[model samples]
Structure formats: structure tokens, C-alpha cells
Target: MIKKAVIPAAGFGTRFLPATKAVPKEMLPIVDKPNLQYIIEEAINSGIEDIIIVTGRNKKAMEDHFDRSVELELLLEKTNKHELLNTVEQISNLVDIHYVRQKEPLGLGHAILCTKKFIGNEPFAVLLPDDIIDNEEPALKQMVNHYNDVQSSILGVKEVPHNDVDKYGIVEIEKSSTSLYPIKGVVEKPAVDVAPSNLAIVGRYILTPEIFDKLENVKPDAKGEIQLTDAIESLRFDQSIYACALEGTRYDVGDKFGFLQATFDFAMKREELHEPLKKYLKEKLEE
Candidate 1:
């Protein structure tokens, strides 16, 4: 069983600029909750009992966000804000969450490698906070279910426009009729014409303990950062790795436009904001 999950959030989100200068990108708010919280909730919903968040310097805020805040709780209690108090308490007691410092912003692969000691010798799931997937069946849960059936590594994949193939790690898959495709290999940000397939790897993965060895052996790319895709490609040579087409609407909250879209979409779902937000948008569009 995949009881442990890792969230590699050590990256300095330079894309978000001044806002991210002092704040970890993972801690950025989506609606009322931090982006990382959604990913953690998804893991818990997927049956993961423990989570190790790989963090870095200046990421203390992320840790504090999950930790208890007695002062704030007392304030909320004193104000009789029971709803807000319960929400705060629930976040602190969500799951058995732990943290490990990545020490440097080497790369996603390196961040994940830092969690080896906590993972020990077991299969685990990796979820990227950037990809906030909204679905009836949580994206991570779908991957977890697939992992249980195959007993092998699973990569959450989604088809992308051919023109955008260069934006993602494209997977080469053997022809399959089902949503699950047998991954032949993975190419990181290949040119559109050269991309093996339109299926791009998103932020979710269920990998075996053997991947740690592959990650350690992977040479850094030209940027001197180890890439998880490169390690996964190498691991594919040793074991079967399948890409499961995740059924969901994925919002790439790491990008500016995507973040806005997620914010708007999430706002539209809230009962208090739905009609007013819709009316506002409709009026703006008619302007």
C-alpha cells in the first residue's frame, strides 16, 4: 500500500516574482486555502497516511501554515467565529505531515531525493502543488487506484495541444485502447515536431522505491539541475511504467494566467460569490 506521499516544494517560484520573493509559491492562496493544502487534502483522500513536504529556506511560512496557531485560535474563539476556528483546527490536525529541508534549489528530482530517509523502502506518491486538478475523483486518488491494480509505477498524464508539447515532459507510449497507456519513454520539453505523443506528464506520480537509485544516478541537465523526468526515463528501462490519463480539469496555478483562471473558477463555485461573480463577468464582457 502507498501510505507515504511526498510534495517537492523547494523550488523558488521566480515566475510569481515580488509576491513570491518572501512567500513560498506552494503557500500562495487559492480561494481561502494555500495551494499546497489542496494537494495534501487530495493525498489524504487517496488513502495516504503520511506526507513529507520537501521544503527549503524561506519556506518556514509553509510549515507554520500547517502548524497550530494558538493565538489565532484563541482570537477566533473569543470572537465566537466558530466556523473559522474549526477550519483552522482541522488544517492543523489534517494528517501526519512532516517536513525535510532540501538545502538547495537543485530541482524537482533533487527535492524528492531528499525525502529518501523518510520514505525508507516503500512505494510512494509524488504530487506537484502547481497542478491543481479538480475532479469528482481526485486526480491523486485515480492514480492511486491505478497503482493498486498494476502494482507498478503510474504517471498521471493528460493530452495537451500539439503546439504546447514543448511546454511539458512528453511521454512515448505504446498504442493502447484504454485510458492507461504503457509508457515506452519520456522526453523533457521536446520540440513540437519531435514530440513522441501529445500526452504530457502532469504533477502526479506513484513510484517504486527503486526510483531513488535512478534519481541518484541521473546526471544533471545543462542547467545543472537533476530532472525527475530523466530519472523516470531511466527507470522505465528497468521496470514497467504506465501513464494513466487523468480525468479532470487541471489548472496550472504556477503560471500567472493559470492562477487567475483557477481563482476565478474556484470563486465561481462558491455559493456567496457565484451569481455576483457571474454577473460581474457578464457585464465586463458586454462592455
Candidate 2:
């Protein structure tokens, strides 16, 4: 069972622009709760007992979110808002939240390395908040089930257009089966025509702890950053790595357009806003 999960929230959300100037990107709300909260809930529901967040400077908002706010609790206490107080308390009680500082923005590999001590010897899930998945069974839970059954590290896969393969980690298939396929290798941002497959490795991953060592040995790739895909591919010679096409809609909230789309779609899913938001969009469309 994957008991530990790490969420790396140290990146500067440059795509969100002026709004993200002072705010942590993870804290941006899709509609109600912060974006990171969605990922946290998903991890908790997937049976991840411990959540280790790798944060950096100016990311205190991320830390304070998981911690108790004594002042606000007192204010709510005076107001006698019992329900609100309970909701506030729920944040700290949700799960065991641990934090490690990533002092440098070396790469995704560095972010994972920051939590080495906390992960110890167990397999863990790494969920990137940028990729918000909509599924009946949470994406991580689905991956976890696959990992337990196969006893192999798994990557979340989603088919993309051939031209877009260069935008992600493209997989090279070595063996194919009914459901699972062994990857010969993975190339991050390979040129469009040279990509081996259109099945791109998404942000969700169930990785063995041994990835830490592979990450340590990998040299910096094209952009002078240690790409985690490079490390995962390096492990192919010894470890069995598998990919599963995630069973739902995945919104790449990292981009500006995707973020706006997530806000619109997520808001449209709420009982309170669905009809009204749809009507509003339809009216605007007519205009």
C-alpha cells in the first residue's frame, strides 16, 4: 500500500501572472477551496496516510493552510459559528501533514529528493496539483490499486495529439499487453516527429522509493534541470515501470487557458451554480 505521498508546491506559478505575484499558485481557488486542497483530498481518499509537501520561500501560505489558525478560531468562537469552526478544525485533522523545504529550484527531481527522509523505504505517490483529474475513483487510488496488484511503479497516461507529444514525456514501448505495457524508455519534450508514442505521461505517479537514487545520478537535461522523466527512464533497466491511461477528465491547470477552463467547468459542476453558470455562459455566447 502507498502510505506516503509528496506534493511539490514550490514552483512559481508564472502562468497565473499578477494574481500569483504574492499568492502561492496552489492556493488559487477553482471555485471555493484552494487548488491544492483538491489534490490533498484526492490523496487522502486514496489511502495516503502522510502528505509531505515540499515548499519554499514565500510559500508559508501553503504551510499555514494545513496548520491551525488560532486567531481565526478565536474569532469564529466569539461569533458562535459552530459549523464554520468545525470546518476550520477539519483542515488540521484531515491527515498527517509534513513539510520539507526545497531551498533551490533545481528541478522536479530535486523536489522529490527533498522528502527522502520522510518517505524512508516505502513506495509513494506524487500528485502534481497542476493536473486536476475528474474521476469516480480518484486517479491516485486507481494507480495505487494497479501498483499493489503488479508490484511495479506506475505512471498515469493519457493520449494526446501526435503534435503535442513534444510538450510532455513521450513513452517508448518495449512490450505491449492487453492492459499493461513495459516502456523501453521515456523522452521528455522530444521533437514532435521523433516521439515514439502519443501516450503522454501525466503528472500523477506511483513511484518506488528507489527513484531517489536514480534521480541523484541523472545529469541535467536540455534546460539545465534534472527532469524526473529522465530519472524514471533510467530505472527502466532494473525496475518494472508501468503506465495506466487514467479513467477520467484531466485539466492541465498549469496554463492560463486551462486554469480559466477549470474554473468554468468546476463551477458548472456544483449544484448551486450549474444551471445559473450555464445560463450565463449561453447568454454571453449569444451576445
Cα lDDT, all candidates:
0.93, 0.88
Model 1 misplaced regions, further than 4 Å: none
| Per-residue alpha-carbon lDDT of candidate 1 for residues 1-287, written as tens digits (9 for 90 to 100) | 99999998888899998999999999899888899998999999999999999988899998899899999999999999999999999999999999999987788899999999999999999999999999989998998888888899999999999999999999999988888889998999999999999999899999999999999999999988989999999999899999999999999999999999999999999999999999998999999
Best by TM-score: 1
Candidate 1 clashes: the total is 0
lDDT of 2 by residue, 38-131 (tens): 8999999999999999998788898888899999999999999988999899987899999999988898988998899999988999999899
Per-prediction TM-score to the true structure, in the order listed: 0.98, 0.95
Q: What's the count of clashing pairs in each model shown?
A: 0, 0
lDDT of 2 at 90: 96
lDDT score of residue 216 within candidate 1: 98
